[model samples]
Target: MHCQPDYKHEVYIWLKSNQMCLLCDEATHSAATLCNTCEIDLPWLTDGCEVCALPLPISGLVCGQCQRSPPAFRQVVAPWTYGFPLDSLISRFKHQGRWPLGQMLASLLRQCLQDRFDNAELARPDRLLPVPMAAKRLRQRGYNQAAMLARWLSRDLDLPLDEHLLLRPHDTVAQQQLDAKQRQRNLLKAFALAPGAQVQGQHLALVDDVLTTGATAHSMARLLMQAGARQVDVYCLARTPKPGT
Candidate 1:
């Protein structure tokens, strides 16, 4: 079931009280409008493999790379291909210090969830977990984009958002520079459950802004299942389609 935005008058009041710029504030602008600079300069994933969400030929459902070796996550859904205006929007939300875009992006992600659940034989997760960031990154960024998205999604989906259930234990090299195997290895042991965390018999949905290599989501999902989650689903605002397609 999908809920329309209420656009509470308090939303604007809260924005003003927080001294946040609805369009330019560091937290949510990516949710409102993309800045001119980032709108033109950001890198985008134009074409990608369907299974892994890596750029690929548009003709096949699963690319050769995924056929040879599959990822751990069961399925993935993204609203837009990671390209152009969308890429710029993400870059600003991620790198340019705009955090509010997280909310806007979450709105988009909510729509994707509604569509997928409406059209497919998918199970709705009981909980939503954001792909966590390392302590250092969290401090530097002042917020986790995934967590921000998860918070809003929780409101939209009426599911509890468990922010502390999972955490990134160690910082790893950027996955963008790694190959499939290297990407998996780099993220290995990078995430772990928080002390005394419990997810027994629950369904979990992992949220992230972008699905690049599926390495990070795979690692996180494994941990969630180890903690007793019965099922896991992956959600992102954009998927980097394989290179050619």
Candidate 2:
């Protein structure tokens, strides 16, 4: 599910400026590595279900699935659909340890959140929580991509990052290729709240690389709400479209 990145492509993200675009190799006259043209061409999610961020034909409409059974999270805020160079970049950052790419994406995501905040379209969460990865997978990958993103977002957004507030003690069968129902079943008991976590009445955001089926986010949000959290929202790099849509 991951790859080894070419060493030549790696860069010390913060220490570098006037960077080359990761996708096009154009000189980006900014601290961010992505060039403006490539950023414009990325798969921006202009319209989606307000609650789930499931790709929809219009911007503010709730999908039938959310209407039938509302998810625990209040909203899913993602800036892009899972497609194209964005997907490839995420794969490299997530699976191949290309952290500079991850940082670039997180910076863009921060911009999205900031715009929403300025327009009163989103409420700032009390805490940012990365989706807890299973220990086995964490060991194999040498990092949790979600946590890395959360760290960067926390720094940029001046939000609290709780890396240990949630725990994923064990691994499950891969959720890829599984339908929504099966994915939910696979994630049952996949997460736990850490001892003494003070989640009560706290608005929290779950950070992850991508939102696919919404199964994982739903499960985790339900867990937090059951434990007395006030609200939950999802913050991720991209959202996959509904199947066949």
Candidate 3:
């Protein structure tokens, strides 16, 4: 059996009840100030590439890289660009054992989805799939941050969360250090649909904590397509803006 974090649900409930900020862990002043930390230090992504959500020139819809070679996922949605307080929060949630932050991240993601789908004509997914981590990495982390966020998102969106639909078969090298081409190469064959997991004719949304090179999400998207998923949307908390843009 996979090792599940003990306080995942508990922390989520606490955040819902306490009215604390997701970013700062203090009392929230208003709907605008959902959390204390978000008020003063909220890292916002004002200008981002439409295709991958990477920070870009405010006027362009797609980044040069994305235009040259599009990714497999249909669209990417992220509340903030990876930077400052957002980066610190992600680090805490993933590495420092702060599971409550997952709830906060999910809350933001939920809001972003509402905003995106409200005035747009996009179809919502039938199910949510968290990008699976390798078994070895899952053991070391004790929990998959993507899974945690997906659980909360599933509840918020009234969609089913499919935890076993995809598996990360190989532990690929980190994408942070790799260029776009190298990143894609490293993630090839890193993911596969689990045996007997049927996604035929289903619209699936892939959730993750961050979108860096888009390599992992693209790999997962390819696997889902092979499993007969009708469509795949990528959702994440943060998008690391391409450097210098």
Candidate 4:
């Protein structure tokens, strides 16, 4: 009797979880690690600004901010709102080096992007460009999160990735802590085109892990257009909710 420690259920649960829902650590039959239940419950963006993808109360309409001064990009597409679990997961993925979390987010983005294509919400871009990171940041982080996401998207969408075209000349102060004006000024001349990299008339989509305040995306889009890109569209994992939303 002392030899039987009742470990049967624990072993069964562990085996089931390995083959099942990664979110709740429960048994399931889904091929994806994240079960349908968890996916459905994620803070999926329902309505957002047409131009910037900022979470909004209405759909199919541009927000006041975009109207006042439109973004350089033609459109922005983000699947989820940056809140709760997504925020925590992104934090772990970006800062804590949790690759699986990034992979899960990228897989979900692929599915969401398909739905967008089916609904004709977005058109396939000619090329994908991950937001450039400074050399120092890249070395410090060991990987650029945007580039990783873009690589995943390239495989999923069969789109070519052109990271060589864009270059960050220097590391600017983090944009999160700055106001809109300061963020814009901080990024001035921070990005530059690689010598002889052609972008004329190319419809490019810039990819990143998150869109906060739209400052960085706008800056990048502007740079692309200045280099003769016909259009730039933004793709991100999540869009931070409008302040106080």
Candidate 5:
């Protein structure tokens, strides 16, 4: 028999509260799907560049890349480095259509961001903007993971979201398949702002599932900045460590 949406939601919540840890298979004993021990053990990005969030030898130091040429965004905020189970989980969520995994990660990211907001470590954005996907790619994926993340974040954070403000009108090479330079080249002139969108003096956050090279974030942030956005920041679940680190 089919269940109503509300009933399904209630069931989902019930399962969540009684869930096993996604990694360790222990009873979570909490609303979170991850047990505290396993959660703490996840590849947390403890010390990183103040601007780009690249894992660093010490806290509060800028990576040389960012020092020489800062990104268009003010900062990148992520909870973990792209490693181990997070890499596996993100791959499954993005390519295999396991949205629950994405939802779980997004929930954790929300908690992390909330703590930062409480501590004044990072200022919240005026709106959440999911990096747009090309139409062909969106059709193949069925749902844009970035958009899903943004929607979940918007609801939980009580932040406004503008899905239509950014547009990826043309398809580019899959970013994961390219080197940083190639990825940058692939995205050249690949993104566009929606006509009549008002970004002037606004602080924006670009939401995505993972940040590998920062190529896409840079491209999108540049687009928004050129349109007079006051500030742009990236919010993602994971940040890849520096290449070969």
Candidate 6:
């Protein structure tokens, strides 16, 4: 005869699937790593430029910068503006080597991408390219934050990840320490495509944790297009708003 489920086993299963908020001890009512309250309160972007996803006064309007000179990447899909607790969490994950926070943030980004897809705000692409880390930085940090996020997205989205296809030939000074003009100059000729790789007529999605000055993503996209990728889109977790916006 079939037997009834064990009461203690049922409780264990429920507890395992129901996760507490990462920010607090309260139950999140589901398997989500973050609670609804925290997720909603995060710095979500509203009005923005389509090309670079820069914050603008109105939606569907191109920013002055993009109008004058468009970036190589076609569009940017970023859900949150970089600030507050999200910034602090990313800082810890990136600087302190806290892997759990990185994982949690990746999961949240997957959810955000799903929401955008559902609402027709974004489109799916053929491949995901995690931004390459310089060898020195990789050796020091023990991980690439972009690659870590790409790993999670690869599974969640069931998309192919070209994590190793892009290579950084030269290590430039930190982009954070430079102004936008300096960032652009520093990133010139910084990325190279591996020989024998084929991306002709393919839609590539560049994955990164954040977009600061847009120089790095633009540089990578230019290289991809020059190498014959049909289209390039950016999928980043966060974007810093324009100063004085």
Q: Please, what are the lDDT tens digits per residue for candidate 6 over residues 1-245?
A: 21211233433353468777767668887866678888888888888888888887788988899999999999998878898879988888788766666777877789888888789977788999999988887877677888878877998888899877899989999999999999999998899988887889899999998998899999999988988998999988898999876
Compared with the true structure, what per-residue lDDT tens digits does model 3 show for residues 33-108?
Answer: 2544454466777778877888876745788878888877887888788888779888998888787766767787
Instruction: List model 4 lDDT by residue over 98-134, tens digit each.
Output: 6667777988898888788789967888999999888
The model with the greatest lDDT is 2
Off by over 4 Å in 2: 1-15
Local distance difference test, candidate 3: 0.80
Tell me the tens digit of each residue's lDDT in model 1 across 152-199: 888988888898888888988878898878998898789988888888
- Provide the lowest-lDDT 10-residue window in model 2: 1-10
lDDT of each: 0.70, 0.89, 0.80, 0.84, 0.88, 0.84
Lowest summed-lDDT stretch of 10 residues in model 6? 1-10
Task: Score every model by TM-score.
Answer: 0.75, 0.93, 0.88, 0.90, 0.93, 0.89
Using lDDT as the yardstick, the better of models 4 and 5 is 5
**Alpha-carbon runs more than 4 Å astray in model 1:** 1-60, 119-121
Q: What would the per-residue lDDT of candidate 5 be over residues 1-245, giving only the tens digit for each residue?
A: 11111223643674467778878888887777778898788899999999889999899899998988889999999999999988998999788877677788999999999999989988989999999988888877677889889988999899999998999999988898998789999999999998899999999999998888798999999999999999999999999998889
Model 5 deviation from the true structure expressed as Cα RMSD, one decimal place = 3.4
Better of 4 and 6 by TM-score: 4
For model 2, what is the error of residue 8's alpha carbon versus the real structure, in angstroms, after optimal superposition?
17
